[model samples]
Target chain A: MTPSSFVKLDGVAKRWNGQLGVEGISLDIPEGSFTALLGPSGCGKSTTLRLLAGLELPDEGTISIDGKDVTTSAASDRNLSMVFQSYALFPHLSVAENVVFGLKVRRVSKKERQVKLHRALEITGLLGYERRKPGELSGGQRQRVALARAIVAGQRLCLMDEPLSNLDAKLRNAVRKDIKKLQRDLGITVVYVTHDQTEAMSMADTVVLMKDGHIQQIGSPDDLYSRPNNTFVAEFVGAPPMALIDATAFASVFDNSATVGIRAENIQIVPSGQGRLRCVVTESEFLGAETLIGLDHAGASGLCVLKPGLAMVAEGSEIDIDFQDESLHVFDADGQRLTG
Target chain B: MSAHANLERRRQAIYGWLLLSPAAVLLTLFAFYPSIATLWSSLFSRGTRRRPSEFVGGENYTDLFADPTFWLVVKNNLLYAGVTIPVSIFIALSMALWANSKISARGFVRTAYFTPTVLPMIAAANLWLFFYTPGLGVLDQIGSVFGLPSVNWLGQPETALWAIIIVTIWKEAGFFMIFYLAALQTIPEDLKEAADIEGASRWTYTRRIVLPLLMPTTLFIAVNAIINSVKLIDHLFILTKGGPSDASKLILYYIWEMAFAFFDAPSAAAMTIMVIAVLGVVAAVQFFYLDRRTHYQ
Candidate 1:
């Protein structure tokens, strides 16, 4: 209901074949911001995107775009555009033709459609390849064609479902940067779906983390990464996931049924007696610029510590573990963060 | 160059031939040899077996070109292919879309539509003959009950070919539909959703996205439809038998009558050669059309 709000889902629910795909969910995507719905497969992230795209109607509640109720509106009338994961370019159409398909469908004049198609292709850096079919393009190039098709429509809202997942790592990185740059330049609101937390963290203005058909935490990427609300978010957001340790081992550090979370890079591996906990190194992985020491502690859950340079200790080598008191996140029996 | 190199090359050639021997033998016996024999036979006179005949190269072809009956049969074949291919394709596309939609009893409906495809074409031809009977037939009965004139469905020259075309379309549309259905199903759901969000109307999406993507399947069905129309001859036997005025006659029926009914073996062989040539041309056109469109996915 806010002025700058571009899309809103109110009590939206959807089910398929008697199974709950998405439960009552309410959220808003503001204008001119890139947001990502990040979740694992079948976690209802794609389902949420489908509902917002008007591809699937919510079983309960309403959906709105630009403050207009469009819950029952046909998908064709929704004034939105989407890029599919498959990069679903028409195989028989040239790149320019694919980009102009929406305009042609709307009966736009040929001259106008041509101008828009060229602009879209140029923006996507596909200017010289207008006459080529999608089959002739590489995976990354095909993805750009899909992007161009969506961009040429110039709809108020754009939805992308794992658009870069099909590209190789190198192309994915390049396309990811291109997507963020294009979003900033165009000021178009985008609701991107990706299972890659890194994609969400790097490209999204706001990240909506979902799990099992429910929204886990919706916040800026840094907020979700640094101050996750539950065990799920804490574990889901970071690469080389946050190390969870039994808080009871350090009874002085906690007052209740013990739990503590530390990100991989947060836990420091000091000399054997510099910290409160004593541990034995189990395994170590030498990543460039950092070494992840997998350790075993007495009366505590296993921990993976990111230390500078090569292995500070060999397997079965006794090592001291330490984390700043303020950096250690303490949680209760139910995995909710507990305050001091 | 060297003895071992030569030996290895010979071994590869032997293995290659061994791998291809079955297909090569079958093609020579069934396709290549028969076609050559038919072409050779077409160059000879159609005299009785007791009298030795002399070669008359291209005479059969000249005679076929000159004959009004042969031209009429060719025209009939073209009419059959032209009408049946387009009409059946249209019906198949429509039926595929309808059956694929969120219709209640979709499986049952699909089964019902496809049931005719499995029935023997000869048996189906006989069944349609009963329906086309004048006055007391099912079609006539239905027409008379509505106070419409009960016209002879297949007896008349003007209506016989049309009646055959209708039955052929009805019989084959479902078979063609299964191909279209498979093509339709292969189109990613994401593409359809993308079109919908682009504000493309249903017709626009189908025309621009669905149809073009299914081009391969369309060409496939078209080639098969033409082949089936030209080669198959069940309807002629039950309904018109080359018609009141040879109206419902197809090339195959004419060939049958030429060889067996008229006992003109060389003429029949010549006509058969022509038919094969026509089929080859049609097949070649399809091959090129398909070659250009194949996505190599």
Candidate 2:
């Protein structure tokens, strides 16, 4: 592997009692980059992270970190740290003690441990709370403690499993920025596992979208959103996900039997008899700055168009929606993206 | 105050008392009344057929202090508590750790470890009685196979107390293990995974994380174990019965012997009062002192 590939997994597969965990899982993460394993629950995102952390062994293939084979090694031997979703702070230990526990175990000098602990806590904005136990801290403060603990060891690689999931929405947004900034400033390679697409897209430099224990696509957030590999990725990557139209509905446009995919923003409300397709306004949702007008068509599902503020249309009103031919995405019968 | 407010306040007072009455009545009937009655009777001489009973303040207690058998039982009990409390707790913790790990037949292992706890103390004592019964006993039977002498476990003075201690530990450890197991399950699995990623070894994880987290349970089990050291002497009745020289006697067994076997009710009442006082003090210390140091999740 090249030096850019700081961590690599090749043909990693894990099965429990003949049940699939993850199969043919291969990935390469560059140094000092943020890669997110994004998927819904039971899609093996966490399982892949666990396998890379050395918390679980793979049934096949190899994992190497910093050019060293570490597939069979213990989690500790692999030289990494992780933040759990529960924030897994040692409940009895004070913030400082929890952060420095691994250092003490590693026989680091007390002075060095104190230095590292102070730096980590300061970075995580938890400086004054070092003396407080986890039980005494707020949920957000406890989560910061978990972050401090993960960073205190100064490992080159850090893994985070839905670390912000337990926090409230406002706090999640703030911590999300803080984590991305932490990864950037520290120059650490971070592998984050999250079910929230917004978290993956907003924070990660590379998003590896997965489904049903297999990778759907591995690309930059823009790539996944703009050029999805399959129907699952096309629908999963964007908000108000991409809508699909059966080929028969648009048989006059394309001769091959394929599905048409289009983004919500590309579809517009056109005057009667002038639009490509006629649709009815089913419902309209008033967002703070915009309104999402839901459209119903016999040939389409999840067809909606974004309109400017306060665009309330009465339900059951017929509206014609039109889109450019070039903007449509074509997929084969198996849902694989078809190149023109 | 307004008449309506006053009426509401009176109703709340009555409601509060109604909530407390069940516990108040139970404690008075079972604990408080019995303790006061024991103290009252302890100050009097035991009544005889020819003589009426008369109050002899603190005389029964003085007689107990003068008795050699009382001191012997106290010493035996101290030794028993000192040895069995730590031994049983350690065994229970070890067994709990082993059984909690990811192993094949985990359900069977847990059930096997918990079987002795499910059996009643008297029934378990009888089951061990067969093991301690001199020649045909399991201990001697195993010893004979190793070409060792078939020594009497419960008949002799030195071995008799130890024999009782062994049965107590065996019976008590399994019961304590169940508590440890329950406490272990409350600990999140991700904590261990977090520890492992931090490079903590199995021993370090146990000592630093597992042991500290289990402090509350340990404190609770310790109080239970101390109370049990005084309370559970049923095995002594079956296995050693205060023995050839009162070598295997515990304080409770001596109290039972004083009241029922020898029919000296005053002495038994005095001893009973002392036992309650010691246990009450221990419970107080556990709540006021040790509870502060223990961590609850």
Candidate 3:
């Protein structure tokens, strides 16, 4: 382990009722980095977060924080804090009380606790809302209160499970930027869990994609987006989803009967003869700045091309869609990456 | 022009009133009538022992004020409420926390703690009366084992009320535990986990997080325990019967003695009105205290 390794999960596995919940997962979270555990529901992403939080004991392997074995440590001894998705504030307490609850529990002096509570409230932009109950706050405000509570604990490591999932889309976007900026500014090591791929792609320094209790891939967001090691990562990381085509038809493009993947933005709809592949535009989605065209290729099949918003392609228009050979992604029969 | 629509509207109105009238009448008959009657009765006076049935306006209230026994019973009620409310709620909270802990045989333990709630108070009082017997009783036997004095619990004026209070706490703590358990379960596991991660010890969590979160339930159970302490009289029947110089007799038991033992109906009615007045004040205090705190959810 490196000296900067903040949290390290070494060969961790968990089982319940003779069923595997997380199996042989290993990763190192560097200090002061914002990492995201990204996967579909039931993919054990939340389970991995819970394991790191000491909410669940691993049935095998070991977990450590800053090189200390914490597998057997109680959650109270972990020196970490978590913000739940539900924003579980004490309903009976005022906002100030909720934020200072941890300090009070640790028997900190009331004077120091008040100082820390004020600082946390200022940081979370909840300074004047301290007198109100949680029931009186909006969902976004409640989330801020939850964040304030976590911030007041002063623990170096913070775990968040879908913290912004409960907010409206507009609020989610705002809080997302706020959280990312806060994480970067505070230099606190944060491990966030989310099923929203966009949330992971937009906020993470390192993204660990999980599937069925196993670590599918662990890399920087740019690395996973630009050079996915498997078909699952390729399919999971991008929006409008990576259009998949059977590579067997394009014999010159690949040497095997593999699945070829290309991001929607990579494919271009060009005039015929300017491109190597020809297709008919079946449908089009006109986003504000770009238009996505769905194309039906003769053999490769189900190709989509993203074009500038000004491109006006009528229905049933014959268009040639193309990408550079280097931009092609090839995967074998089992969805394992063959070529980047 | 729309006869059927008119009939339907009429049907809905009739059904609404039909559904409402039963409760309205029951409340008026059982809840409202006695209250109004008690208030009316308080305005009357107690007659002489020979006639015992004359009316002089507000004279009974004045006589009640002059009677030292009335003030003593009021003091006893306050003591009972003070002791039982805090003790029962504390014991219930502790039991609920224990029953909800990650211990072995939690279900069996919960059932055992809750068993007293379902047992009749009269039966429990009878059983305790046997245990509080002077000699050859289980309590005295245990006291002898501990090398304690063989003092009669209910036969002494000093200890009689406390003995009854102890029995009341035992009888009602389990009943209140069920409310506390429900509230405890409603507290999401995440808050507990959050407190744990904050380096809070178990006692700190109980005192800061768990107890504060359970405030509404505490208020609820406190009100219930207070009401039950005021009204319940099985202990008065079995162990003390207002004996040892009437030190253990509650206001309701005193009213029962005045009405039946001495056959003084008007004075019993007057005392009954006084008890209701005291209870009304306590109920109002609870209502306002809880009203300010009710979250409505």
Question: What interface RMSD does candidate 3 have?
Answer: 2.0
Would you list the rank order by DockQ, best first?
A: 2, 1, 3
lDDT of 3 by residue, B57-159 (tens): 7776677679788778777877888898899888998999999889999999889988877878888888888888888678999999999978798899999
Poorly placed runs, candidate 1 (over 4 Å): A1-4, B1-16, B147-151, B289-297
DockQ measured for candidate 2: 0.84
Question: Which run of 10 residues does model 1 chain B get worst, by summed lDDT?
Answer: B288-297
lDDT by residue (B96-126, candidate 2, tens digit) is 9999999899999889988988999899989
Q: Please identify model 3 stretches exceeding 4 Å from their true place.
A: A1-4, A107-115, A249-252, A268-284, A294-303, A310-324, B1-25, B42-53, B62-79, B129-163, B238-240, B244-247, B289-297
How high is each candidate's interface RMSD, in Å?
Answer: 1.9, 0.9, 2.0
Ordered by TM-score, highest first, the candidates read 2, 1, 3
Best by TM-score: 2
**What fnat does each of the candidate structures reach?**
0.77, 0.91, 0.82
DockQ of 3: 0.52
Which segments of model 2 are wrong by more than 4 Å? A255-257, B1-10
* Candidate 2 TM-score versus the reference: 0.97
Single-chain TM-score of chain A, each candidate: 0.96, 0.98, 0.95
lDDT of 3 by residue, A70-117 (tens): 998988788888899998888778999888887887789999998999
> What number of clashing residue pairs does each candidate have, in the order they appear?
0, 0, 0
